[model samples]
Target chain A: MKRLLKTVKNNFLSVFFIVYIAVGMVSVCKPQALNIIDGFLQSDRSLSYLIKAPVLKLLDIRYGGVNLEPDIKLKAFYIHLNRLIQRVIGNDYIYDAGPKNDVVRLNNGYLTTCLPKLTD
Target chain B: MLFSSTVFLFAFLPVVIFGYYVIFRKSRLLQNIFLLIMSLIFYAWGEPKFVLVMMLSIIVNWALGLPAAKYRDNKVRARAVIAAAAVFNIGLMFIFKYLIFTLENINSVFGLQIPVPQITLPIGISFFTFQAFSYVIDVYRNDGEMQKNPLNVGLYISFFPQLIAGPIVRYQTVANEIKNRKETLSDFTTGVERFIVGFLKKVMLANTMAVVADAAFDAKDAISPSFAWLGALAYTFQIFFDFAGYSDMGIGLGRMFGFHFLENFDYPYISKSITEFWRRWHISLGTWFRDYVYFPLGGSRVNSKARLVFNLFVVWFLTGVWHGANWTFLVWGLMYFVILTVEKLSGIPKKEGRLLIIPKYIYTMLLVIFGWVIFRAESLGAAGEYFKAMFGFNGGTFISDDTVFYLKNNLVMFVASAVFSLPVAPLLRKKLMSAGERTRRAADAAYTAALLLMFVVAVSYMIKGTYNPFIYFNF
Candidate 1:
């Protein structure tokens, strides 16, 4: 009996970790839209920008003129934070942009003009 | 089956795993027979006719291996047998993969009317042939005993996991495991985790970057300096993750079957020099060449400069040509050989201590990024154009809105690939393993959960996405 108690004492942190992850997951699931946004931002850069640009625009409404560079940083933070949310929720809700809107083009804009038109 | 395919994940793997475990509970001999049948089925799924070619090679090598083992003491006869085996393997490879290229070059040079024969190159031919040849050579050299059982030899050659795209498991590495290996619960768990991580790396990371890489490489002359760099960088990561991911899957599947395959990659992107990069990348193939090809030709021990140059040239020449029947691949291999030779000749002191490591890594990365231009280009001329574009040599007016848009879209995936390509997971695992009891348990739990989540997402992606064949399948 004493040995069992001692074992639990030794792994107290693990117990706490499980509880923490569980609670975080529950909190994440409550706001499905935010969870989805977070999941999308985790892997999809274009989708990340779509979410961030609008949110930053709102923040700019309150703050009165946020610098473009700082807004980029803020957007990155949002994406990172949402990735954490995704891990906690254990669900992926990220929307995939269809093949029509090429994600590569968004990531590498310098190639747009030089890109060849597909005829067939 | 390709590692990236839905059929492989959803259909083949699950069935194989369940069937193997169900049979394994009955008898060990039954297990081997089950695995052999499954392997044959797997190979036939892709190329039904070519499986015959694989079987023919396996039968010849197995027969040769036994006799070579019997006459191991007769150096002359053994040498002749080994030579015949090598020629047969290499000769078949040449006819299938290089016949067209050889004929085209001959026609161009001699003004002949010889037409290039069209042939569909068999997938995984190079990998399986190399594995088969190595077995015979090992028997001839007395480095390992020939498997008395033909079934064991057959399993080693066509072991489905690493057979298609390989770290080229040697005859010696899995010789014991072929007869005796017991999988524990821990082994199965770790195997599942490894497979999950590899699947995510392929579906999530490598596939994402491949989109951009294909667009940029296909763009050819129209690609701007920035766009070309991005494309090349994406491809560099894409190829590494794609191949590394497949290797991890192969290794993981091996572990699940109670085999312990050697690690094929060790954070190759983190390499400090081109030499170090080669040491870490495709470690099995490099070691194979070093042991079988380099050492036999007198290696670096020879006093003659000519011999030294010859050994290096042969190793690199085979290395390049081993990848494909393309001039670009040959140049890519030669480029590495030149860099390695210069580094050796200069006698530069190896950088020591922590501070200099970053600079070394950056330098190595730059060299690798440049090398990918040759690897990805369709021809030598196209590779030259791509390299020139990388340096902003084509009048710097190539940047366009479309390029910026693509960059914007793929930015997240590109960055993720770059980060994950390092030794982050292994480093974390090491730390977790060494930590206190409580911390270790927590880390284990987190790692397991993360692996499970990654597996779910990866499978979901696989189901939705088109099948992408492994890059090295051609090699």
Candidate 2:
């Protein structure tokens, strides 16, 4: 018991990180938990912006900001977690049904780009 | 599951570590059994049905291993046992890995329309099968003790760390450790640090380079000469960091559980000759071919130059075919065979003096980069087209805006990859070892901080859903 305690004490940081990761995993599975995290992040405007601005910019590039729903302040967070879950289950889901800037359309045997447009 | 995946990092690894160290700490047998179960779970997470394939391998090898050791005094029976083991293991690999490729080739050659079977390869079939063969051979040769328990054999063969993509841990390397090895705090901490470094290498360096390499290789038309070189160089670094990073993580994870795997790579990019390059690159697989294939075929004890060439041809041909069922891999292996054979016959690498080091280094790297081009291509014709573009024979521009854009965006990462691929880490450790106690302590603290930062950044990349592809998993 003493040895076990000693090992635990020595590895306190590892335990904390593991717990944090577990919580993150659970949060992704639970939309309500993600909403809570979003509420927490939104409590501080500058901090939320600092954490979210680059993510939104990246989403803008790949997904054209189609998932920027009004209710979900951490839309990217949710999408990222959902995508991970989908991948783990071996299903590649396309979250953005909106205009994909990279996809080309075949218009009468000629290729044309799908022009960039933000749906949200 | 990929080591870089969130599922592995966040769920699988932590749980296994906790169970092993906390629950089964005092019991080696239980720990081994626990590890085996967890390893199966780890593999099953990717493909549930393939678990049966691995279990089949474990059971057959274990059964063969007993007779292999028992009938060692009888030459005929022993030879038969070993041959049966080889046929079973190789036949497994052949059906899953090579049957389709072989059928297609045969059909094309004979002008017949034989239908190839649709088979999904079990992940890491090559790695586990090779490890299984090593076990039986090691038991037969008395290089390692034969496990009486089938579960122990299963644990040795299916241990998750090196199971998927391996340094190809031989039975002799961990035979003793399997039964009686001590896990220490110091080893655990060092293992954590090593795992973090590998995570950074995979998630940051290799993935970033994959972006550039994929762009260049997957271009619809011929790319500029500069872009071709950049893509080739990117792929060179990408393969190194990807495989080496996985090896580091495997070794680190092995250490975390008191199993020490052999080092797979040793700064292979820094080699001055192709001979030296093979010596340092994928050392496990190279040594595997050397011991099991080359030595059994009279190795370097041949009488004639033709014999030596024949021996090398077999090894390199199998080495290429072992990588994938692609003609590209065969050509890549043959390319090395040609270079290494010339080096060996002429004794040039051995005879060269220190003055020619730079030239030798440049020559080796150029060949290696070109070799990667072949390895990365979809077909020989595609590789030829890539070479044409690389040499400005495709009427492609020398330098284009696309080339400049990629170079500018990835300059820092490219420089970092080049510097880290050298012996910088070892040199820094050597310097730190000579420092004062207080300074050493400070350096240790800084090292821990850096590791934490790297872990954060790597996990963030995982969360961000980046282009994280593992190259060696196909092999």
Candidate 3:
């Protein structure tokens, strides 16, 4: 026990930072997880195709809406964040010429569909 | 990635630190490999394509370093090898950093429309290229051994802490440590303390000053004289804290991993002359130029004054051009060359007079502040306009409500920045040390607590997504 205490005292900074960073990781990564899920669904990779249809079916959500069913307030926040990200990535300038695809128009006047944005 | 960013603070740094300390604790080679991979990832997080450019630099420089070392006994061949390395690195820098600037200048001068390609500069090109040069040159000079492994070369040049913005670690400084080093608990704690101090300096002081500086500078022609001066002063503190804080964090991170990089700054604001200021401010770059450029050109030891002047001119010209491909930076460098030449000839700095120190300090700081004005301006014309306002020649008032408003809002931060720019904290700690053993113990505990508080506050600022602009990242 004394040896344990001595080790902790010697490596106090390492201990402190490990605990602090663990707490920080949870705080910072939670929102990012939601964003990553959105990215996977929107991405053009073949792996994304495997879960895209079933996940959307399971959640019973529109292609444009937030998934993973975060709380209503959290979903609103995530949508706001998604819009901001879209604006930053120049997706806002993209306009829908026709609506043949399974598309939904966001209030921000940008199309929100599983298909890749025309800007890309 | 910026040290002040939440992603770097919470995600990138923690993961790297965990892997460094825990997973690879027993193996030095594995730790070095881990560090190199993580460094490349950290750099590529911003722009993935540039990783190719960096890898090209590492492989080529490492390849050159081998032959440079091999041919050391043959003077001409070794010299040729080092020259080739120099040209390659400089050519790479010129292509990415200065091709457009050079083309545009030529188009204007020769009255021909030369098509300039739009080149997006890879961040830290200046820093890493210089490190690559340092490695080859050091190996040739026998200051350090040649690394047989290309990954070790990559690790030295792309060490994430000092990679993007640097204290520009010399190759000789960490050559042995790359192969053999031990991380101690004491070094870890000290690194933590130093990193926290840098984090607070950057997030609290530099970012706050940046807001005021940006407001006035962005206002451009309409600013009052008082406001113009306030902007200059704000920028003065902003840059010092930003770059120095970065260097501190880099040094701290180096310590955590058991690499002791040299001090980059030493309270330059307290200098009594431009010469002293250069010695104190950005000591790494200054020394790099001195050892690599000036000393090779015979420095001040040339017998003829004309030769000495020529050498100084070349060094200063390159120094100016080294900052960026900007007329303002060039003019700023030349401005220093002129002042430094005058100082050297006049023997002003070495003169002994206690009463002269105050004026000497004011003179140095004023010149520095004006230099920063030139450095910070968008162009030479904009700098002139700003100076006109600063001198009340732009038809602007001396004192205005806007100036007062900014002053009042930022007075606390300004005062704190000014105080911390000196050696006050270190001096205070010194005095505390001499008081008593009990007092010293209490002081140590208080210091640790203060560091903890500062870390929490700095991280809070990061979480809040504050105004964090790194000035030296451009260079």
Candidate 4:
């Protein structure tokens, strides 16, 4: 214990991080303290993770509740929209930089709407 | 997975730290077993199916080490087994990483329809394969005694720190520690601090730089000349912090586990020449090739100039190929070779008068910045386009509104990157050591608080799930 303190006693950065990690441990122990960060970010862990911006903005799901619901309406709309677009465009054609690829769909090899649109 | 991940930070790291220290503290054997399993779990989490590939690597290397060691005196059998082990490691890398690349090139050139076996590269295959190769080769060379215990050998190869990315710790370096290691609170605390530094570098600087760099390269239209330069500079900083930061994290993590791995980077950007840059950058890999490959081929001690050139070519070519399956990496490696060749033939003293030093620095940075363009580009075509943009070859505008916007917005980041990329931490400690106790203590707290705040901000950024993979993960 003396050795630990002796080492920490000299280095201020060590002192700070020790306290910092200790605080994180405290937050882990008291989950309510972890909720403080949630005020800045999305309340749901998975939803917060899904948000891909650099800033800690709220996930603006239109549904309002204590218990969260998946955005089923938005999901269905995108699916139907994509289908309609595909039908209109027919085979081998699609809009460039439209919401079809980047927004609602996970990349599944066949129709990834990300960079390098050309396969070769 | 990624060391910078929420899962790795909050879940995997903390849990493993607790389990290794608290639960298995009393039993060394239990700790070893615990760590082996945990490390396996860690690798598996990232490359689930390739966990078997890694285990097979460990098993084959571990099995081969005995024979290589046993036949150390017998010339014929020793060379055969070593050759076989090398083949196995290199062969695994070729089939997985290079086969598709080879087939594509062949098909393109010969005008044949060879079906491409395009598979996603197994993560860390290069790192682990080289590590496994090091073990067998080191044993053959009698650099380290052969470990009889397969688990110990497995631990040496698959230790979580430096597993995916590396300083490429030589077997001889950790052979003893694999058998016996002691964890101290001092080392643990230092490790924590080092990890935080690395985490901040990755999360803050590298990732931010990546956003700008990726934007410039992936621009729908050709970016302005200045934007090309800006992207190139950002990528220069990005690759440095991204890889060096990962190395620090790896070293720090190794410290927590009582393994003292060597330093990997030494501020290569500070160098005045390309020769010095290679020395400071990726020191372990440089040394590995020097000792194992270069020295065997007569290194610089060859009688003829041709032999010396051949040695350098082999080393650099291998160095470049070791980076990726792509021709770009090979070219990137050869570019360095050509520069060094010119430097050698020119016979101009690298060390210049103080007045000439600035020009030397500019020369080094220019080549490196251009080299990184080749490195960061998706293809030779993209690289050519980027070069044209950088030099204003066909002519776009000098600067774009977006370029000015990025510079203005990221002014602080640019300044911070330049300042911190030097040996700032050590410099701070040196200056602080002479200050009065109270002053030093206050400075410490201030630095610590700043780091804590940085971590909080970085965590917030991370929770937003920004694109934050280490660039070397591709390598």
**How many residue pairs collide in each prediction?**
25, 0, 0, 0
Task: State the lDDT of candidate 2 residue by residue for B1-475, as single tens digits.
Answer: 7888765775568779888978998788899899999999889866788999999999999999999999989999999999999999999999999999999999999998999999999999999999999999999999999999999999999999999999899999998998988898767766776777888899778977887898899999778999999999999999999999999999988988888888999999999989999999999999999999999998879999899999999999999999999999999999999999999999878866778989989999999999999999999999999999999998846998768867876776799799989999899878999999999878776776677766765665555543678998998
Model 3 misplaced regions, further than 4 Å = A3-14, A30-120
TM-score of chain B, per candidate? Answer: 0.96, 0.98, 0.99, 0.97
Model 2: residue B58 alpha-carbon error in angstroms:
0.5
lDDT of 1 by residue, B26-89 (tens): 7777788778888887887666789888988899899989879987888888888888898899
- Local lDDT at B377 for model 3: 94
Over the stretch B88-173, how does candidate 4's per-residue lDDT look in tens digits?
Answer: 99999998888998999999999998999768888788888888999999999888879888888888888888988887889988
CA lDDT, every model vs. true structure: 0.75, 0.82, 0.83, 0.77
Output the lDDT of residue B326, model 3.
Answer: 97
Better of 1 and 3 by TM-score: 3
Range of the 10 consecutive residues with the lowest summed lDDT in candidate 2 chain B: B457-466
TM-score of chain A of 2: 0.27
Each candidate's fnat, listed in order, reads: 0.00, 0.07, 0.18, 0.07
Model 1's interface RMSD = 14.8
After superposition, the stretches of candidate 2 with alpha carbons farther than 4 Å from their true spots are A1-120
DockQ, per model, reads 0.02, 0.07, 0.11, 0.06
lDDT of 3 by residue, B236-276 (tens): 99999999999999999899999989999999999998989
Candidate 2 falls in which docking quality class?
Answer: incorrect
- Candidate 1 chain B worst ten-residue window by lDDT: B459-468
